[model samples]
Structures are given as C-alpha cells and as structure tokens.
Target chain A: MNYEVHNWGLNVGNVEITGVASSSIFLIGDNETIKLTSFYDTPPDSYIVGSLVPLRHPTIEEGTDNG
Target chain B: MDKRVAHIGKTRINSIAYSSMFEIGDANTFTPTSRVIAVQKEGGVETDEGFEFDQYELFSQEPSNVPDSLTVQQKNYHHNPNIHVENIDVKGISASSIAQLGSLNHIDSVSRIKHIRILEKEQNQNDLIE
Candidate 1:
C-alpha cells in the first residue's frame, strides 16, 4: 500500500451538523477504502421494564406532552 | 488519491443515520456498519419493546476482522473520485444513509440501527366504575 492524497483546495462555510449517526462518515472528497463499524448501546440508565410498558414521567413535567 | 476544488456553503445536516455518509466526491470503497440502540423515554413511547432484549448479541456477532480489511493488497492507484460542492442544505438522511454529489467507483454501505423509546410508570387506580 503506497499512496498520495493531494486533496487540494477545499473551501467551506457553515457546516452545521446536529447528527450523523452510528456508523458515520462525512467525506468531502477522495477515498480509497474506508470501513467503519459502530455499536452503540446507550447506558445512561438501562431500564428494560416490561409488562405492558408502564413508565412515564408526567409527560416530561407537562411540557411537551410527548406521546 | 487525487482530488481538487471543493467549495461548500451553508451545509447544514440535521440528521444522517445508521451507516451514515455525506460525501461530496471521490470514493472507491466505504464500508459502513452502524448499530445504535438508543432508548430515551421520559414521555415518549412508540413500541419496539427493546427488540426483545438480549442486548443485540453485541451487534449480532460476525466480527472476526471482516477478512482483515478485505485482504489488503493493492497499489499503484488512480483517483478521480470527484467533488464539487457549491451549496447543500440537508434535513435528514435515513437508514442506509448516503448523500453524494459526484464521483464513485465501488462502495459498500451497511447500516443497522434500532432506537427504542418507551416511557410509562405511574398507575394508581382504586376501585372506580362510572
């Protein structure tokens, strides 16, 4: 594997990203071989409480009323 | 790899999911495998039941080095993987996500994401029928 990546002159303005999720890649230009693997298990508070799914928080204190 | 001149303005990406990619130009191979099990439940419930648990068997196995990055052996490469981005404003790119502008040779993208959110708790009922 021998190479040259002379990716020249890239102008940019205002690249705002809220999210690029999981196995993510944002390439502007030039690539040979790229591989990405991501496994995300959100463990803020792992709660797997079943039995007709009953766990609410008063609609987030009655603000959004998110159903 | 040779690429030149990429101009971008006001490129706002709100969301790009799973095997996510937002490319402008020039690509040979981009293998993406994104797995996310996000569970945020404070006041939102929309079924999926946590995918019946088991923690996804840790990405459903199949990780023995992926053939050692496709049996790495290639040289004397050529590049035209082009890109000319002037202006782009994206809102959402979902699942097997890829939003390209120009130039691609061979690409293999893989996306597997499972987001489960279910919130409920506070049931106090006492003898009522009306």
Candidate 2:
C-alpha cells in the first residue's frame, strides 16, 4: 500500500510504502529531502539517530531513523 | 524534544514495540459515545501523553449511543516529532476519526483512543460503568 502524508502547516511530506516494512522514505528540509530506509532495525530505547545530508544546515536535519 | 522518525521510503513501521508513546501536555477530549484515551501512565487527560486508545471498550461504553463525527488533535508545540498517528487495524473507528488522529504523533493518537477503551472495558468487566 502507498500512503501520502501532507502537512497542513509545514511543507514537509512523508511517503511510506509497504512490502519493505523495515524502513520508510521521508522528505526533510526545503527542496532537500532525506530518505531513511532500513536505517535502524531496533530503535534505540532513547537516543537520536540519522543526520542531515550536506547542502542544508545541520540544524534543519532530523534525528531519528525508524519510521 | 519532539521527534520525527519515519521510514526513508516505507511508511509502515517495523516493530510493534515502538507503537504509540505520546507525551504529556497534548490536547484531548471525551464524551458519551465520544472515544478518547481512558488510561494514562504519566499524564492525565488534560495533557496528551500520546497514549494509545482501546476501541472495543470505547464503543462498548454505550454501544447503543450512536457514535458522533468529531475531530481531535494535539496543540502546536515548538518542537514536534514526525509522529505517525494512524489506526493500522481496521478497528471499529470511523475513517475520519483515524485521519484526525493520524495527523499527530503516532503514539499520542493511539494512546488517546485506546486508553479510554481499555478503561471502559475493564469497568464493564467489574460492573463499574454501565
């Protein structure tokens, strides 16, 4: 199944697809989206994962990996 | 710090362990036949703990009291996580309800709905609330 999540406020968008239940694709930053797939199998009990690509400022990046 | 965790390409979750873990200080309401999370581990109903809701008990509270069409969401926060709030299960919940809850953090949505149903269910078992 394909799910398209649109935010009413933030321009951020998320698209999740089944079949590969392991990871999900997310769009972060302006014009520069980030895709986190199979990044972390077992999410940490309480810790930050994932990082911002390059072009965008590090602050505008995400922390968690599991979707 | 509100967090956002999503599958890079896939929208579905991998494990059921990290289901819904809503934090306190969220928006939620309840009414007769109106479903809401009944039980919370830390915060009260005033604050949204992102608690998951139990559907069976929600409807059972007043099965005859027809369900109403409503919308419930969390208040805006400076730091919000990319939470996935959707009822994966084909629960008795109406589609609109799911969508409303789906807009917020995954954990909060579930807790808000499931918690109440769970409480009501237990009440029924003990003959507490009719």
Candidate 3:
C-alpha cells in the first residue's frame, strides 16, 4: 500500500517499519514530506519528494514502541 | 505583617512579604505561579498528575479545554472502540507546536525534533524493517 507522510518533526532521522499481525506493515516517523510504500511481508520504502510538505497522515500507531 | 477582617461574608485576609492568605465563606480561586500538575472536576473528572487527562471523553468533547502549558495525549477509543493504540511517543515538543498539529485523529506515536540532517545515502529496506 502507498501512503503520504507529513506533520513529522524534522528531528526524525528515519522511519522504522514494523510488521503487525499477519503481514501488516506500518511506517512510523515524526514529520516530513515523503511518499512511502509498504509491502505485506517486506519493509516499507520511502522517497522524499521536492519541498512539498504534506499534512499529518494517520499512519503512526498510538503507543506502539515509545516506552 | 497586615491582617484585615471583613464582615461582609466573614472573610479574613492576611498578607505577608511574599504571600497572601484569604479565608472566605464562598468559593476561593487561586492562581499558581507554576504549572498546574492536575485537575479534578466535581463530577468524577480526575486528571492524573503531570497534566495527563485519562478521560478520553473530555478530549473528544472539547480538546481546547486542555491547558496549553501542559502536555496531553488524546486517543480516539470512543469513536473506534475496537481500535487498539499500542504506543505513542511525543517528547521535547513545545506547547505551540502541539497545538498546531491539531486533531490527532489516527496517530499512535509522536516525538519532538531537536535537529535535522538530510541522508546522503539511500536507506535500505531490509535495515528499516524489524
């Protein structure tokens, strides 16, 4: 699946992909303008487009890793 | 030290160098110099310490009710009861920035940024997946 990423802080170095139940992959980041592709069993890949920053997208799951 | 007694409503007022004390019959409002750690409403609305409001209803109802100086987390469990929020990490974020983020409709984790540097080399997919 392809998703638009945005509203992440510039401090985020890179996004980390994690596989949930059954072959669901999630792409997580703080903020930026990028296009990402998530594969069922494979890790996601992202490409930063020009300087077109997008709005916040619903991708990062709540309280999944931050402990 | 100065002490004044008012017969209007049996109120006693005492003032010393730095602080002032008030004893009134009716309600009393106090303004703190620092941030408020917690808030408890009359009808079972109890926010935890560190300005954390556990009641998702309050946030869903009126997100603006939350103080700007405090940090907060809003989960849409009421709208999507079956949704399970595993984790959300937001740190080092300023109050103004959080307000700009607006509604956290489907977000799970968030963190504040301290610096930014473009990656010269492309990231490998295998390295990102865990």
Candidate 4:
C-alpha cells in the first residue's frame, strides 16, 4: 500500500511520521523530528508526512450509561 | 480648568507597571506569556509549548471541566489521506509539550471505521428460503 496509517492514528501520543518513499520514518515519542526535501520532477511532491501527536486523555467513564 | 496648572510638570511614569497600564507596548503584556500551542504571537518564543498536562487536562472532574468554548471537530473523515506535521522532534518533545499544544483550540480528528471484518462476514451470511 502506498499509504497506510494504523490505529489510534492522529493525536495519539506524539508519534510522528516523516519523509517520503522508502526514506519515510515513523517517529515515536522521544524521537528526532523528520524533515523532507522536495523532488524536482514532482513539483508538488514536497511535503511533510505525519499526524498530530495527540496527548492521550484518560478515559472518562459515563456517570449514566442510559442504555 | 487651567492649562498652566496642569502643565506644572510632565512626570513620566517610568515604572514597569505604569508602562504596562497604558498602551505603551503590545497589549499582549496583559495576557499570560504562556503560548497556547495554536495561537500566534509577535515573539518567536514557543507560545503553545507552555501548557502542562496538569493545567490543560480537559476531562478532569473538578478543575478539568471542559471549557465553555472548547474546540470541536465539525467534520469527520474516515481513513483519509495523511497530512504531515513539522517542527516537532520526538526526542525534543514531551507529553507535557503535547498537552500544551492541545490547549490551543484546534480540532484534530482521525476518522476510521471499526468492526469492518465482522461487518463483512455478516454481509455474506444469508438465510435459505423455506
């Protein structure tokens, strides 16, 4: 698959992915920030790749399920 | 109402508090220096990186009540294309830093469907007609 994002994707614990093609990387928390460079052939190819590393909020229990 | 009486002296209020009271500098002086992650500022200082989790936790029972104007996601896209983020070094960033960023009112949502495999199985099942 060209693009694949697994579970808890966006804003899930500061994990970031960067780069393109084989050069891309998945940066976990405490990892280095990844920067990408543009390719001349594909003018629009230049872009950073990653979702916002979200801070996981503790699960909130419903006082009344209403079920 | 005598101009001469008022012109007795032009005493300059040099104190920092006085300077802040008037529109001497940017009005930002009255606002806290903590940079809410999404908010912009004149200075290059990281404004949004200053909120600690303890300060910005949204679901806390007592103090963590959601703000009256909390940001919400208006659109939900499932398993959509991914967008890249810059200026964040995983090693350089901390959970607290992320918490600070969350304090800023931005809706970041990831839309994905669950139980797809189970749903597919259910779709294939059929009851034989009597």
Candidate 5:
C-alpha cells in the first residue's frame, strides 16, 4: 500500500462541553485507540414522583471481595 | 500524526471521578473499570436464576434493547488523530473516566452500572412498622 502525507494549519475557535462522565473521555490532541464501556440500568418503574432516591445497601459477606 | 503548535485559551473541569485520569501530555495505555449495582424495592426482584458480576443479565430478555456493541468483547483498534483546540470546558469526569489535553496512544475503559427504583406513590414502608 502507498500513502501520501500532507500537513496543513489546523485551527479551532472554541469548545464547550457540559459533562464527561461515566467512563468517558475528553481528548484534545491525538490518540491511537479508545474503548469505552458503560452499563446503565435505570428502570422506568424506579423513577417516581420526586427527585429523591432511596438507595439500598448491598448485603455481602464480610470476607467477600467487593472489587 | 503531524506535530504542530497547540494552543488553548482556557480549560475548566468541574470534577473528576473517584477512579479517573487527567493527563496533559501523552499516555501509552489507560485501562479503567467501574462497577455499580443498585436495587430499590419492597424486597427485591426475583427470578428462577440470579445474576453475577462476571455474567450478563436483564429483567426481561429483549433482543432489541441489549445490542452487540454494548457487550463485552476483546478486539483490536487503530487510529491516526490530530487536533488543535481552544477554550475547553468540561463539567465532570466520572466512573473511571479520562481527560487528556495532548496526545494518547491507547485507552480502554469499562463501566457497569445498574439502577432499579421501585416505590409507591404514597410512602408506606418504615423501619418500625409498615
């Protein structure tokens, strides 16, 4: 395979982002590879009336590896 | 990638995650993993078989919902990137996330989160009585 190379002036004005969350990334220069995985389970039945959420405590053994 | 002058007027990041990264130059590899499981109900959701950390599950088996891209897999990737930016503003980086300003070689991130909320319109359950 044959490839040609060209270099040109790269310019940008402004960048605005609200959030980079939950295993997300914000890069500014250059990268080779990026792999991001996210799993969200917010059931519709769970979201009710108000904005309050009563979190539960997981019941695990003392010696269990909670990694 | 070509080398050139990189300029930025301002950069602001509100927050970073408990397990996250913020780099300014360059990185070889980045691998971050996050796992979160939540359940809310009178007791709990039940089925014939339970789920595990190393396994995959769903409340109901829906083929369209859970796609193949979301599934865990091992693959190879290649990239050729270059950028010039100014005034970057980010809100937050959470759940094993990364924020870079220069250049990166490779990045692999994983996040597993599960949230289930089950509540009645009227609050009924209590600690001492129902």
Candidate 6:
C-alpha cells in the first residue's frame, strides 16, 4: 500500500469594507417687514419669526372674526 | 333977471348943504366888521358778517361695511440645499482560493471587498406661509 496523502482545498473568509458617505449643508437667512390692516389682517395664532410692525386704525379692533 | 339969479343961488346953496351933511354921516357911521366860525365832527360805522360750518359725523361700523383697499406684502424666500448622509453599506464581496500540494496540504485564500455610499440633500424648502 502506498502511504501518500494530498490535501487540496480552498478556504476564503474575513473581508473588510470601508467608505465615507458625507453630505453638503446649507444655511439661509431672511429679513422682512409685514403690515396688518382691515382687509389683510394677521391671524390670531400666527407664528412670528422676526420683527413685527402693526399699523392699526383707532376704531378697528384686532383679530375680530367677521365671518 | 334978478329973480332968476336969486332962485338959482338958493337951489345951489341947498344942494351943497345936503351933499356935505350926507358925506359926513356916511364917513362917521359906516365902519366894516366881519367874523367867521368853523366846526368839524367825525363818525364810525361797523358791520357783522355771517359764518357757516358744515359739521360731518363719522361713525365706526362693521368691517364688512368698509371698502376693501388694504394690501398684503408678500416675500419670496430663496432656497438652499440641505445635504446629509443617506446610506452606507457593503455592495458586494469577492473571494478566491488556491490549493498547493508539494509535501503537505496547503491552502492560500484571498478576498476582495466592495463598498457603496449614498448621499442625499434637500432640493427645495417648504412653504412658510399661506
């Protein structure tokens, strides 16, 4: 009997992957003036983000529901 | 002739006496005198004129009664892109192996890894107001 052994096999494992995923950023600025009157009146629950200057008549009331 | 002469002499003597007496009386009694006086007075008058004013009454009513003349100022804001990392993952994996048989069993292995990255950003901003 011939005493000879041949081991032929292939094994592959342990893989590593790396990457960089970045995004761009943007910043915006705004400045504005608003006017309130009888016809185009401001809402009662309006969110004010900047300076607000309101010009109102003496006889007229603010935030009155005319509907 | 004697009577005519006597009459003429008597008439002349009478005329001469009358003329002399009248001249003496006029020169003695006729003295001229004159006097004058003046007065002045002032007066004033005043008048009153009528005045008229048209009184206007202004009343406050409901907003529906008033005319719609008010306007609203609208502002259009600029847009900016907001970017951020969306996803990061391994795309694929590849592996290969070689077998060598000289005296003992030997195996050599190699692997090639791939990766993928994704980025996302905002194209427009949301509506701020109605």
- By lDDT, who's the top model here? 5
Q: Residue-wise lDDT of candidate 1 within B28-74, one digit each (tens)?
A: 66565545566667776477564554567666765456545435444
Interface RMSD, per-candidate values to 1 decimal: 10.4, 21.4, 21.8, 23.9, 9.4, 51.3
Worst 10 residues of 6 chain A by lDDT: A20-29
lDDT string for model 4 (B5-119, tens) is: 0011111222221111212111111111111122223344344344454453332323224446544434333342332233332222111112121112221211111110112
What range of 10 consecutive residues in model 4 chain B has the weakest lDDT sum?
Answer: B1-10
TM-score of each: 0.36, 0.14, 0.13, 0.14, 0.58, 0.11
lDDT value, candidate 1, whole model? 0.52
Question: Predicted candidate 1: interface RMSD?
Answer: 10.4
Which portion of correct inter-chain contacts appears in model 2?
0.00
Regions of model 2 farther than 4 Å from truth: A1-8, A14-67, B1-10, B18-130
Candidate 6 local lDDT, residue B109: 23
Model 1 lDDT tens row, A1-67: 5433344334454454444444444555444555545444454334545344445644367566576
Clash pairs detected, candidate 1: A54-B120, A54-B121, A55-B119, A55-B120, A55-B121, A56-B120, A56-B121, B26-B81
Considering lDDT, which of the candidate structures 4 and 5 is the better prediction for this target? 5
Ranking by TM-score: 5, 1, 2, 4, 3, 6
Error of 1 at A64 (Å): 24
State which candidate, 1 or 3, has the greater lDDT. Answer: 1
- Candidate 5: tens digits of C-alpha lDDT, residues A2-37: 344444556677777877777788877656568776
Extract clashing residue pairs from model 4. Answer: A11-A54, A12-A54, A30-B91, A31-B90, A31-B91, A50-B84, B35-B47, B35-B48, B36-B48, B37-B48
Classified by CAPRI criteria, candidate 1 counts as incorrect
Q: Give the CA lDDT, 0 to 100, for residue A34 in model 4.
A: 26
Q: Candidate 1's error at B16, in angstroms? A: 4.8
Kindly give the stretch of ten consecutive residues in candidate 6 chain B with the minimal lDDT sum: B1-10
- Clashing pairs for model 5 are A46-B117
Better of 4 and 6 by lDDT: 4
Off by over 4 Å in 5: A1-7, A45-67, B1-5, B38-83, B120-130
